[model samples]
Target: MDLIDRVNEISKRIKTLGTTLQTEEATKNALIMPFIQALGYDVFNPIEVIPEFTTDHGVKKGEKVDYAVTKDNEIIMLFECKKFGAELSPGHASQLYRYFSVSEARFGVLTNGATYMFFTDLDKPNQMDAKPFFTLDMQKFEKQEIDELKKFTKPSFNLDEILNTASDLKYTNEVKKILNAEVENPSDDLVRFFTAKIYSGRLTQPVLEQFRLIVKRAHKQFITDKINERLETALAHPELSVKDNASPSVLLNEVSVELDNGVVTTEEEIEAYNIVKAILRTKAGASRIVMRDTKSYCGVLLDDNNRKPLCRFHFNAKQKYLGLMTDKVETRVPIESIDDIFEHADKLVETLNEYG
Candidate 1:
């Protein structure tokens, strides 16, 4: 199965196994090995995947990192493992900080076999930062996030490509945080600039008070306007034939269905459509799957580029009519909960298996 499916499956497994296997070794055995394998790396290969990687850090002897992934005799990635149930704080990354600077590794990962945080150097070249550049939580998976994570997988791994965007990725997030702080509370520089610009020669106590109020109100209004725009974007695409209520909770529930001719139905069919879309993304030959809105059900339209008709699941349509779709089309079984997407994830591999 692909990285996305593997993440989904491992998340479910973690929930099922619970906190029983909470030890450091158990985490390595249960979660770490599986994660390495899913990335298309051979866990059994000592050359490629070296566990208990020893490195000299000052006076500390027998100091070892959890694992180091090497390619062409050079370390590409370093991993520092923690106990399964342990909460990972910035304090736990001291080892990684030391190892990252000493080694040739461009990327560093801190994982408890569940949450993976990827870090890279932003301040100094060829070094790893203490803070993660990006993070992926197995407990909560999203399609776009999975796509980003796939860039690190063994098959697609490119050190130059990763390094190329490391500076931008690392600094963008830091910039955003600083901007948010400034927006929340204006700094002395901002106040001085605005004060000088608006009240240069005609400044009095009353005018200064009025100017402050005006600036604050204008800033608040600007923030409010931007927030409204964001909310509109989030709620932009209305559910076709589902419901037009303004309540977000209600909309979220009805989002998976399409009502037809005043008949509310087709939740199952929509789920099947999602499955097919997921499968299509895994196929290298397949073009973008354009899903259509329907009154009674969603439609997975054929991409002219691929010229391949994938399966259709008509939730409201009769079973006999469902077979009317092209015979060459592939079928994917429907899954219920979003968490259950991992159940038949192998089908995704089947779709991509032909690529090679």
Candidate 2:
């Protein structure tokens, strides 16, 4: 299987089996090992993937990480793992922090099986960053993220390449998350920033609220229009795009170049995702409602998974349809706009109740 498929298969394992995994050893065996294997590593090869990999720090003897990945008999990365559901603190990565500089490794990974944080020496040379350079939610799989993780695979591992972009990726992800939050519920200052461009009126509460929705709509529209524009351009002239012979990293850049850059989600789809979450917040916790987007449709599930979706979004087409499932029956409800999500509130809850 390809890296995305392999990691996605493991993602399924995490969604279903992770909550049931009760101990550190079980996480190591069931989650961590498979993750290592999915990265094209030989879990059985002690020389390549050393279990209980040790590093000595003066009086601290037998200081070990769970696994140490090597190339050419030299350690490139160290991994420390915690049991599933265990809260990972800096203390959990203490050994990794201590071992990072001591060992030849430049990268360190701290994970609780489901959430992985990658650390490196961005702030200080050879010292592991107090904050992780990159983080991954195993259950919340993103193709671009999986592609980035593929850099660490046995076949593609390159220290210089990973380190060179580590700083940029770290800050870029942080910025995207901040922008994403602003897009959902813009800050008053942000609203004012846009209001200044159009209005000369006083900054009042009602005006702020009025401008917030407009700002959000404009942002969403901007993204949607840009995406449509690029898609049209690419469709019209595929050769004008990045060549097939371009390097994987160059190809990776092509994806992030777009504003609505999600592999599965679009600007409108994210708005829909938020609306679905808001509606289902009362039915069950918002955390339980997972959105998985595929080529054909975006599947919304109550942990029912892609196999048995609670609903699907056919938003790609001109006429948007919300596919709802209830009592072993599936039905598609056409909607004029994303605002129509609330109209199907009763049906949304019914499917959750049926599958709950």
What tens digits encode model 2's per-residue C-alpha lDDT throughout 51-106? 99877898999877899988899998899999998987656799999999899999
- Clashing residue pairs for model 2: none
Give the range where candidate 2 is weakest over 10 consecutive residues by summed lDDT: 243-252
Worst 10 residues of 1 by lDDT: 317-326
Alpha-carbon lDDT, every model: 0.65, 0.81
Please give the TM-score that candidate 1 achieves against the real structure: 0.55
Off by over 4 Å in 2: 89-91, 227-356
Residue 208's lDDT within candidate 1 is 63
